[model samples]
Target chain A: MSNWVLKGLQSGVVTTRYPRKEEKAQGISPGFPDIDSQGGDINGREEDVCPTAALYGDSNSLKLDKGRCIHCFRCVRNTGHPVSWTSGFEWASFTEKGTPFPKIFQKSLYIRVVDSGDCGACLNEVKLLNNPLYNMHRLGLFITPTPRQADILLIVGPVTDHMKTALRKTYDAMPEPKRVMAVGSCALTGGIFSSGFTSGSGVSSLIPVDIEIPGCPPPPLAVLHGLLTLAGRTK
Target chain B: MKLQETVNQMQSRWNTELKIDLDLSAGTAVVHCERNTVPPLCGWLFNTMEYHFTGLVPEEGTEEWKLIYFFTGEADLGSIQVQTSAPLNEETFQSVSPIVHAVDWHEREAEDLFGLVFEGHPRLGDFVLHDDAWQEGLAPMRSGFDSDLAHSQRKPKSNWKPRKVLDAPGAFVMPIGPVFSGEAESSHFLLETIGEEIVRALPRLFFKYRGVEKLAEGKSIHDALLLSERFAGTTAFSHALTFCTAAEKLSGGQIPERAELLRIFFAEMERFRHHIGIIEGICSSTGLVVAASQAGILEEKMLRLTGKLTGHRYFFGLAVPGGLSRDTDDEAIKEALKEIKGILHDLNTLEKLLKKTSSFLDRLEDVGIITPQQAQDFELAGPMARGSHFCNDVRKLLPYGMYPSLQFEVPCEREGDGYARLRIFFEEARQAAAFMNQAAAMIKPGPVYTPYSGGEGTALAGVETPGGASWQWLRVDKNNRITRYRIMPPSFANWHGFHLAVEKFAFQDFPIIKATLGLSVAENDR
Candidate 1:
């Protein structure tokens, strides 16, 4: 035990200085593709290449829905006319029903995470927040075991048939002044496993989503941005 | 046993009327037989021939249902696939679970998804589809079933009760999950105990089943590869490699040497991180917060290194049908090798500290024991079986990619306890790092991608995942669309025998035992 303590001291602090300062870690995210203005006319072939149809429309107008993108890189890497790729992890956004929490509840917030039917990647990124590097507890955010004491509900996965009831019951158990944040592409637009025989397209179909963080499985920093945004800490 | 000797014994003892197609180059044999002869043949192969019953794949046909029973043994025997057809009118097939216990869950999954009945199988319903949520006769995997149709949700059954195995005084059943507090996947467990010690352990998983195999029926090879990796994200690269290998076999395409070596490198990297995550789980379960945090930090570093080497942290969108989608430069490979070596040094230091912590050892040593015989009976895979002295590794038994040229040891322990499993994890992680270093040195300058047009054929491929040997069997049409996609993940094989380690343990030991096993619900549920 003494040796462990000494080893801990030797390792020192590895926490990131986010919110106060931007996290400039390389390879922290698999960034999404953005249509470059200088590129030639869109042949509309790139839209068809997207397996999830995140990119659509013709040469007249092109659209990229980040919510539906799983960052497969087909549009940027495999297409003849490639789109420019941007590398930054802050991808969280406020839904129409979203607003920052009141100042009273800003200091501390309890989160209850639900796995509706995720493939496991999204949930894993969420788990990384508790690691020593991310250290979400330092930001006044915690993972509560019960929904009754939770101030926010964090969900991942496309809502599956079996988990639908449990997800709803968790929401109902939460107290007032509660918010729901859906993480990953599956939670936002069902990514690949869209509303099929077994699942709803995303979390918004069953519950009102306050925040949306989009990626195949958003990196830990992106998830941290979502949490801080809910607490009204991010600019 | 030699492949010819087994083939000759089958011909003489069983039926000479059977049609056999031998592919000696691929070391595979396909035997076409009657449906009535399946149980006997599977029993003979499992008991007499001592072949491992890999999985059972159920295929939908125009007028009938086809069942393919897979078996593999030592490299000499390779793999034998038995194909038989049953008419649509006959819903019942003889169960092989009574003789080969490993086929128990496979048969149950078929019954739930395809609405087939396994005769003489004691349990069938309420497996994948929960009785409270899904209506009977849904049969979602049928070809005629519409995937886009919306089905109304059902209310929980008021009369439903869990299966009870103990009726003694003061005995009661305790239910655990389907929903956990943290980021753990949803899985339920019912523990039946009379006092502090549990007598029966019943696990109910698949609450997050997304019907991945059914969704891949009409998808192209590219889209199907995405589904394979997403089904279980932790071991994403291994599953993708398995899918691509199966597809490549169908097209008969040759992979570049550089691509083959890179595949091994990325695969070892994934395995290294996965074992570290398991170590974190074990520490957390034992109430060692500092050690758990230290393990978590190491895992994060590994993930970042992986993302730096391959664009995605989990290796998504990296593996393609013929080869890799992108290439890593030699400079990047050298940098990754250095980082991995440093990580291994720190891991050794942590291991040394952990060994001295008596409190940690007391919790893990001699806890959650599974005997060697039990492992063989259940046909366990990966570290769980290795801890019990079952030394069957897919990389060794069925060599593919660069494994035939690589050097590594499949570590085993005779204790078959939590501590034994932990030691194997540390040892395997070291071996994985060594493999990555060797593969990095073997890398050469070459093309990484080879394009192959779709072809009509059926093929099976297996890869050694973090959990164990995961096999993907695929059948593609001439148009490059998948007709059947079946995944035999290691978790599904090992989950069948999890009860062996839990039944005789105290209730407090459940979480530790579960963490040590480290089975993924997403992999099994998919």
Candidate 2:
């Protein structure tokens, strides 16, 4: 055990100084795509090619729903010019009008992660938030066991019918003023498995959602940004 | 015994007419037999010939529903596919569960999805569909069934009727989960224990079933593959690779040599990270926080490397039907190789420390024991089977892509305990790193994506995932649209072994045993 402790020390401090300082690994994360403003007119082909229907465009303008994007990069690959990968990590937003940040949760927010029917990528990334490099607990964000003790409900996956009752019970179990942060495209817009007998379109169909963090499975940093945004710490 | 010899012996003994096509070049055989002959054939193949029952693939056509039973030999060298059809109106067939026990769940799944009647199946209850959501006599995967109409008409509330809890003198049942506080995936387990020891464990999975297989039907192979890759996060690459391999075979596309090497590279990288994640889970379960954290760091590093190379962290959108969607540059490959070397050094340090840590080993040493016979009976896959001396590594028995030339040892452990499973992970991590290095050297400059030409055909492909070998059966139309896409993930094949292994162990050791197995609910339930 002492040897294990020494080995841990030898590995040095693996924790990151995120929020206070930018992480070096942030550049590698696939963020929401940025449309090329100067290159060409919007041909609207990207809309047809997008598997999740995240991209929609007319002859002149294109719209992107980050919530619906799984970041397959088919748009970027097919168009070869109109759209490109962005380094901007912040993809969270308040869904309701005039909903102020809960000051009570500012110091220590207890999050209950609910898996309605995630494909597993989003859940893996959510688990990474507690890892040493992410160290989300240092920011007063902790994972609670049950919904009753939770301040925020972190949902991942497309809501499957089998888990619908459990997800609702979990939400109802939480105390009032609880916020639901839909993480990943599946939770946001059902991503790819949206239309099926077994899965619901998204989490919002069953419960009110405050924040939507999009990706097939968003990176840990993006997930952190979503939590902070829910707490009104980030723009 | 050779597969060809088995076919000859069956022809001599059985009265039924059989047409056996021995295509050793394809690594599979198609044995056409009458519906009445399934039981005897399965019995002979499973008991006498030492063939492991893989899965049952049911395909619905306009006229008839084709029931195909796939079985692999102990050597993993060849697979035998038995084809028997039932008319659309008369959808009943003899169950192979009585002869080969592993087919119990497979037959149940077929019954639930395709609405086929498996005569004499012990219990064909709700398999993939929810009990509350399931409409009796309604088949979801039938050829003409309208899924959109059914989904739109689904009731908002669950009709969840609880199963009867077992009771006895000092023996009561306790049910837990479907939602867990321990970050465990959505699944329920009903435990019937005597004091501190468990007598029966009934796992109620399918809470996460998104109907991935039903959703894949009628879609183009490319479109369906994205969903397949997401079937499970940890085994994304291998699942995608297997699906793509099946699609490539049906579409008659040639994968470039360079593309083949790249597939092996990505596969090895996926295996490396998954093993690390499993080891980390085991450590955390055993209260080895320091070791767990170290393993977590390694997992994170590997994920970042994969993110850097592929656009997505989980290697999504990396695979396509013909070949890869994107090509890795030589510089990136070199960089990845260097990182792998560094990971190997870190792995060596962790392994040394773990071996010296007596407390961690003590917790894992004798717990969750599975014998070689149990593994064979259940047809367990990957490292779990290897830990029980099954010698079931697909890369060695059925070499594909760069594996034919790649050098790596197929590690096996005689002791089938938690510690043995952990040791298999350690050995596999080293071998995966070595494979990555070899693939780096062998990779040559070539076009990654081969334009797919879709034609009418049926094909089957199996690729080794982190847990075990995932077998896929696909049938495509002339336009390359999938008519049928059936997947038997490794987790599905290994779940029975896991259920049996957890039985009779101390209830306190449940978490450790579960962590060591590293089975994914999504993969199993999908």
Candidate 3:
């Protein structure tokens, strides 16, 4: 135990002061694409070259749904219109309010993370939220194993058929006035494996999603930001 | 060569009447034989010759079903491909699972996906697909059955069935989830326990099956590379590299030396992160939360390094057919190498602390033991196999890319227990750092992508993933589109080892055993 304490002392204060201070997550996020100065239409080149069909445009203007964008950067490289990357990690929010946050959950929140049918990318990122750098507990967010104690349900994956029942049961088990947050592109719009025979297009098909954090699998910091946003701790 | 002599002896033993076509470069001997001759050949290869039966691939087209068995032979003589045919309408083949136990799951998967009847095989039931997902006679993977049509005609059937409770006085069955606590992939474990000791463990998997193989069909190999990379997120590069290796072989392109080195660098980087992640799991399972979090810091740093090297965090879209899609800058690679050295030092320190902690060691030592014979019988791979003194590392035995020239050691342990697996993880992590250093030093500037020029054919490629050997076999058409693609991940081969490991242990030991194994359900269910 002495050795353990010595080691802990040696590795001093690795925790980040997020929500209190800006955590500059530069070069860490696979940032979203911003429409460049020359960008108006996708010009048909990016629409054809994109593997996930995340890009769609005619002759007028282009729009990027972060929910569908996987950040493959094929559009940025092969498109006629100039598109650049925007490196912002704080993209989480309580997107829609089915019910207001319960009065008891104002100070602290317990979140239950469910993998409906993820590829494990989003799951890994979510787990990274508990590391020293992103110490979620320090921000008053705790991961509860049981849904009975959860104030928020964080769902990942494309919501496959096999997990539909389990996901529903988990949501039903959570206390009332709870919020549902869907993380990653797969959870929002099924990313690549959309509405297939085996997988649901998105989690909203089964459960009401209040927040959507988007990326192929959003960065860990984005997940932290999402939890904090749900807890009303983010500006 | 010894392989040549063995082939000659096999030809003589088979009465020299069967026509055998040999491709020495690919190390495959194709014999056209009647379907009845398969069982005896498998018996000879597995029972008499002691060859490791790696996988079984069954393909269906209009009239016939093509069955191929992949096996690793003695020394680097190359893998042998056993081929036969059956009518697609009434497909029936003699089951090799009776003789070779490793292919039991393979044969069951074949039965599940292709509607092939494995005569005289035990437990050839639902493995990947649920019973209600398709019709009674139609299999989704066969070319004739449309997945959309199957989905439209779906009938929901209750999957719960009566279980045979063990006949002991106090023994009872306890079922854990298809959805469990924590951030794990969904799987169901039915533990037959008496008091706290588990009598038998039945793992009912396939809760995460998304039909990745079916999704890859008819898709361009370039596009299919994305699907293969997502087959498992943690071991993304190895899976994509294996798929790309097969695709490049089919398309006939030479990967640049620099690209090969880059692939090796990414692979070792993945290994480093995965090893650290497993150590974190071990620490957490043993109630060492501080150590686990410290290891998690190392893992997150590695993830950031990967995000810098490749555009995406999981290193997706970086590996494509022919070679890598983009190249890493020398300065960035230098920085990563320097960071890796520090990470290695921290891991060493953390490992030392854990080794001294009696509580952590007490839970891990001698908890889950798989004897050497059991490891061989089950065809275990990766650190799990190596812990039992089986040198199953594909990088050393079947060298690929820069592994042929790379200097590294395959760590093996004789204890074959939880502690042994932990030691192998530490040793392999150290060796992976050494390999990362060597790859960084040896990398040179060259073109990353090579254009494909060849026509259609089938090709096989295997890579040593962080877990074990992840093999891919792809068949392309003249238009360079994938007609069929089959993957056998390391977890598919080693999941059965969990059954053997969990036997006779207390229920509390479940977490540590599982953490040490670190099996991925997505890879296996795919």
Candidate 4:
């Protein structure tokens, strides 16, 4: 105990200088998967190995609905496309009419993390926003604890039977101009639990899933990208 | 050496068919058995030999329910998960609480969520969902808890009160809260006090029944990791790591050595920051601003580092199926390590100066004392557990990740009080520094992650959380989709230890007492 006090006095301020633009850091858990629907091979590998049925199969065309993508990287890991993640943490949006989507934007967006039927790994991505390194506040992406003040509801996990009601209630609790963005594979198409789900599936079946960010647990950066889309803050 | 032999002998003597399984692909293992046989096996492990009951994880299954008990060894990083099979009859297995005092809350929780009844539980009264609200016959854990039924029957929380002491001699009782101040989620505490000392501190949990366990049902083990992380937000990495380890082992996923090293690096960072944050919180509760400031700065620093390494301060998405989400470049890793090193140096000095401050010492010294006997009886873990003279560190006993290779010390004090707990955290942070530093130096340059697809398998993986060991059992059926996912976090076990501390301390010491005990509602509720 005595020694601990001594150590404390010596440590200096360790907070990050975020919005100040002191570092080219993209914040934690950032990811915006750029799947060139036009790139056939990249799409082929991604479609072949995608653990969840998130990637849509079309004739000579690759379509991606992030709302259902789990970002497992299995698709990217198997191929030779630049899979490097962008750390741009600035993500948020606001709308008085339809719900927003997760995208990179300069104005920032307020996202409310709702644990519908999530495994907790997805919830961690939502939490990364508050950390000093990503400093969602620095990018105007504020995490409103309650749904009322939020525009984009960051949904994690598939909507389990028990959570289905809670998920609806949470959305209902939020102010109108709300958009639902499913952040993990669980939230999109019920990714892994689709058939076995004892209750409901993704937000689309209940409310409306505007965008999906899929990954076993989407990186915080990817989560940021999802939020950016809803806010129309994405480049 | 002796312990291992004894464990092996017991495994043979019991004559239980042991189908050894290692999910080499995912880096995990499984040992399955019948549900009813778990207690006897655990008894042999804990008493006949030297294995300890680390945790009991329950997963939601449609046809049947699966429960796995993780046991730790004396040496070797080996862990055994006892898988017990039971038809979903809603019958609670006999309580292991009598054998491992840690299971008191675990059994109670099982009863509340799974609607399983532990017939012989010494105090099987409601620990979470009130006894009156849910009858012994009603199984809240069943798959049939329809939303319409749940909502239509959304019975209010139990007003079930403890045995009244108000009419007794030298005994009076009062309930603390379902709602509290200062960043605390809702929870109720009932105190039975005699004079100034507390006689019994009954913690009434499950104020916010998030139904996390029920929710993770039927999800693929990989996807379930997200839900596991949510079991407790502050220590999401531990749950995710633990769950992934189980899945990896079940699937025989081969984990790269480099990736394992990265896991340990981030894990240690998490341990340090959380310990610092927790202790600093303790200081703040006592109005020791200077100490609090020191701890706050360290915490803020840690959260910042967490953000940098994994891009989400808490390190989410960092732990995928087979490995981490990404690998740090050499230079980047060095920079991060250096930053941590610098803060740790300062933290060391700050600890010293604060100790010199008389005001801080007066308030902390002898504030909340838990004798060695009480400590052992309660079977506490983490700093609080160590503060009580129990030489139990799951990290050492149940080594995980690169911990078996890393050399570190487990700090202990016999006092078992708020001050001693705080001291243990301080010592632990220092020790963590050494461990993290060594890990960074030994880290081999290579891929930090390995992509793994699933197969039909199951696993029981575990990671040490600030609270204690977090266990997540994952089962993937023939289709490679997750069939069952169960989580057992340390906070569940810590409940018993917390009750011991609370029941003995004064009522006003509630804040400090709760702080010292350090149970996370979000984690436990999940």
Worst 10-residue lDDT window, candidate 3 chain A:
A39-48
Please give the RMSD of candidate 3 to the true structure. 2.2
- Candidate with the larger lDDT of 1 and 3: 1
Question: Candidate 3, clashing residue pairs?
Answer: none
Q: Could you tell me every candidate's TM-score relative to the true structure?
A: 0.97, 0.96, 0.96, 0.72
Candidate 4's C-alpha runs over 4 A off are A1-235, B1-50, B57-70, B76-93, B128-140, B143-149, B155-166, B169-177, B194-197, B453-455
Q: Candidate 2 falls in which docking quality class? A: medium
Worst 10 residues of 4 chain B by lDDT: B177-186
Report the Cα lDDT for candidate 3. Answer: 0.81
Q: Candidate 3: where are CA atoms >4 Å away?
A: A25-27, A37-48, A58-60, A77-82, A93-104, B132-138, B156-159
DockQ of each: 0.64, 0.62, 0.56, 0.12
Worst 10 contiguous positions by lDDT, candidate 2 chain B:
B156-165
Per-residue lDDT of B112 in model 4: 66
lDDT of 4 by residue, A8-122 (tens): 4454434455334344543333354455434433344322345554455642455555545554454444434433333343333222343444233337566766665454446
For B1-526, candidate 2 gives per-residue lDDT tens digits of 3766776687898745788888866657888888889988988888888877778888888788788898777553378989988788998899989888888888988888878888888988666776677666667888778877885666522655555555667877777788888567888888887678878888888899888888888898768888789879778889999988887877667889889999999998999999999988898899888888888888899998898898777888788777887899999999889988998898888888899888888889988999998888888899999999887766766666668787777899999998998999999999888888898898889988777666678888889899988888888887767888888998887876677878888888988899999989888877
Model 3: lDDT of residue B419: 93
Q: Which numbered prediction scores highest in lDDT against the true structure?
A: 1
Candidate 1: which stretches are off by over 4 Å?
Answer: A40-48, A58-61, B153-158
Task: Please give the fraction of native interface contacts (Cα pairs under 8 Å between A and B) kept by each candidate.
Answer: 0.61, 0.63, 0.47, 0.11
Better candidate number, 1 or 2, judged by lDDT: 1
